[model samples]
Target: MSLYGKGFMIWQLARCENGNGVEVARVARAAGLSHVLIKIADGPYTYNVDRTTRVDLVPPVVQELKKNRIQAWGWHYVYGSNPVGEAQIAAQRVNELGLDGYVIDAEVEYKQPGREQAAKAFMAELRKRIPNTPVALCSYRFPVLHPQLPWKAFLDYCDYNMPQVYWQAAHNPADQLRRCVNEFKNLAPYRPIMPTGPVYSAGGWVPTESEMVEFLDAVREHNLSSVNFFAWDYGRKGLIALWNKIAAYPHPIGPQPADIPEQYFSLLNANKPAAIANLYTDDAVHITASKTVQGKEAIQTWHKNFLTNSFPNATFEITSVSGTGSTRSFTWKGVSPSRGKIENGNDTIGLIDGKIAYHYKYFKIT
Candidate 1:
């Protein structure tokens, strides 16, 4: 199915407009949304059946969304630890709810050892039960950052890729969305990416109205068919203005130079100091907080001695990137055994002929 249109994910039906299905539907319709993905199940046995409502809220919620001409899909948070049990419960809930579609919310738990086989088992079981329900895998936005997850295994059987592109601790939704879509497209068994942007605030950080609008704009500009928000409850309560802005944003469709910074981080995470050095010119200079290293050989030695060895398990996650063409700046967070935690690290790179000519790195360890 071609999943196109604006949508919101419903975490708890009971929390929506005081458990009034009609009110919830009215709110969704007012928001100009076309679909609602409701949380139906979590893990093997937990169903989001609100006891206070005294009704199997899924049916009523789905009915209301459908009544408002909004497609209603069910989402299940799969643990992947008990593949068979999780699949059985998810398939049973999907069948019982009679949802228009289903989404598997797989996360870090699925990144454990033997995850590929476990994901296959879950998918196989789910397919055996549903036979023909549209299923999608919803997980991390960056495929490169999560190499352990069984992305191909789950996506191979799924119909769509709904990545949770939550730009947490950052504000550049457009850039992040573009990178998210691009990275997923590079993977095998690629499916249509319908990203879920963050609406709820985390750690005192909430996306602004302008950022939400830019997110929709980026989605449309990328020729992506659909876009969805992370939530409805928090949005309706705290982000009404942002919510309305997104609803009114013109998302009519149509149509990467950041690879060097990306490759630097990737190589750094891989502990390939020599490979990272290769990205720079022979006389490239790397300026740190205390000292500077000039020449490729010196830079390689610095990375091997200070960058890699100092933190064996250190990984740099690019939070945001800015600037035009050759000169670019990026913000990142890193964690390692030696550093413990590094936050708000900034890097400026001057690229010549797609190779780093000069680089400056600054950060604080906490």
Candidate 2:
């Protein structure tokens, strides 16, 4: 029941105008979701966007979700009519009702000039009206929008970036999710990324429960903070079924395997450093050859020194490696990097990244 990183949003599927808005909130909460995104309904079947609606319907939904321990927010979708007005209205509603935040879904012209400035101005006006409300933006992926897109221009006025990464379901969704999160982080390393993942595709390919769990597992694997599903409803039966299946997953994917090579010899033969430093905390320490290295720098220096001294001209060949969370172990046979085939027995234990945390020379000469 610890809902820290999981989030769900209702876009057009459940409208406030309809009597089912309250029930929709119940369903979202029952499914172990911590966030409920209510897409403001301006279309038919929803009550008019007015102060009365805010007082009667909107705030009640927010409170209802809160009662079930779910953080509620308003996501205003903007298109041809210009989103600034709806953004203002939603922000006012959230502010009056004391909700968590607001999301501005902008469908912008990716090829237009001065579009960044226009987006910034819209965000600035929305912020001015909302004052203290946390603002977020939904935009296309970096590759689609160009690497030099005005992310900063919009991010400066907003709090988070929700890039829509609706890639096909492949072998490892987590790796893809990590890559996407990293790309956004590379754009603005300080800001958080809320990637939008699709549960079901338009072609009717619904990801299996294991696959959906794998997607979330991939998110956790990369230490990503949060995620958003592509949509609320589109008459897709598989999506609801998939959500139910994901809810049925015994546990949210816990700590995932570390992204490191299995053996030291493989890394060395591949021209890779025996140890990398940044993958650990600043104060991380390791015991190598019965000698405790205080920090990453010390560990790196020690690892390089030992390998060079023990096997002056040896090459490494990885045997096997596997681990989850922070603990990992690997074994390798050393050979001459230049020579085709000489073997040396020097086993190495790596931590986190490919850093040699502990090393022992099994045989002095082979």
Candidate 3:
């Protein structure tokens, strides 16, 4: 739900609507925003908190956004200096805010000499605390340009990739976005790309309304799920015309239920058993040709064993899907490195409040 349609990123919530939660939500709804991302933490400290007043600025906005049927995602700028501390603060903000999703904003500092271990540490800790919540890695658009950013480390846990495709001085947004997508598609532990376009002015370089449209057009041309505008405060104040243009864009703004199976397949490909298990209800049941398993912990163990031992380094692909109401039927195939392959796989799932309550699988190795 967080990665569907148009999204707006609010760098400083207090700067917008004079810190009025209701007004901020009203603006998001007026602009037809599907999701609003707010900065929750910076480094190892909680952001958007009044240092002197001792007030948390996010809960009200998050609450109001939900009332408006909009997703509220929290973003944090992480420095590799204290990965564990950062992870602790991020997870704390997420749970306390009741966010729909979380984004890890790892940038220049992450490209240091040795942040791979730090990246691994941060993600491991964060996932343990909020395994089921959808996580995204927000970073530079072109992965080739920034090889040292530990793309695999953070992406292994991320459900989406929100690239900062900010065409600051250049007008070639379409080409840059295309290049960004191509570079990311080749990365392992792949996550769906959701681009972030530039909406603010910088150093006398302001993106034209046409450029914003082209950026969004490129998002659709590349079959991306959604597009986000950076610094909502700047966009609303300085680029009202561009903001209006984005609001009028014809992209259908909402999540599709049919995407559930593909999302599950993505997690399978990411090789995260904890995440896969979290997608199910606590009392969920999964049945296979060999045996049946119930409870989330059992499901996690089953997948951990199956994915790690039986089908280590396997790629799962959905062949087809058909469903009605709460029930879905799908076919998938998995090819493993040393264990050969599983084919003709068919499965049925029953969703309860967006979490899988029942799953039945049938497959054969050939």
The superposed Cα distance between candidate 1 and the true structure at residue 177, in angstroms, equals 0.9
Worst 10 residues of 1 by lDDT: 250-259
Can you tell me which runs of candidate 2 are displaced by over 4 Å? 1-3, 13-22, 41-57, 80-87, 143-149, 168-172, 234-238, 250-366
Per-residue lDDT of model 1, residues 1-366, tens digit only: 445678888887677787677887898887777778888888887566766765577777777878887788888898878899999988888878778889999998998999899999999999999889989888999989999999988988998889999989999999999888767755765676789999899899999888888888888776577788888888888888878887787654222122676688888888898998999999999999888999999999988986756656787776656555688787788899766888878899999998999999998878
lDDT of 2 by residue, 67-106 (tens): 7767877776554244466556666666776768777665
Pitting candidate 1 against candidate 2, the one with the higher lDDT is 1
- Candidate 1 RMSD computed on C-alpha atoms after optimal superposition onto the true structure: 12.9
lDDT top scorer: 3
Off by over 4 Å in 1: 51-54, 252-366
All candidates: TM-score: 0.68, 0.60, 0.74
- The model with the greater lDDT, 1 or 3, is 3
lDDT for position 83 in model 3 = 98
Model 3 C-alpha lDDT per residue in residues 170-282, reported as the tens digit of each score: 88999999888767755665577898888898899999988888888887776677888898898788788999999888766765343567778888999988999988999
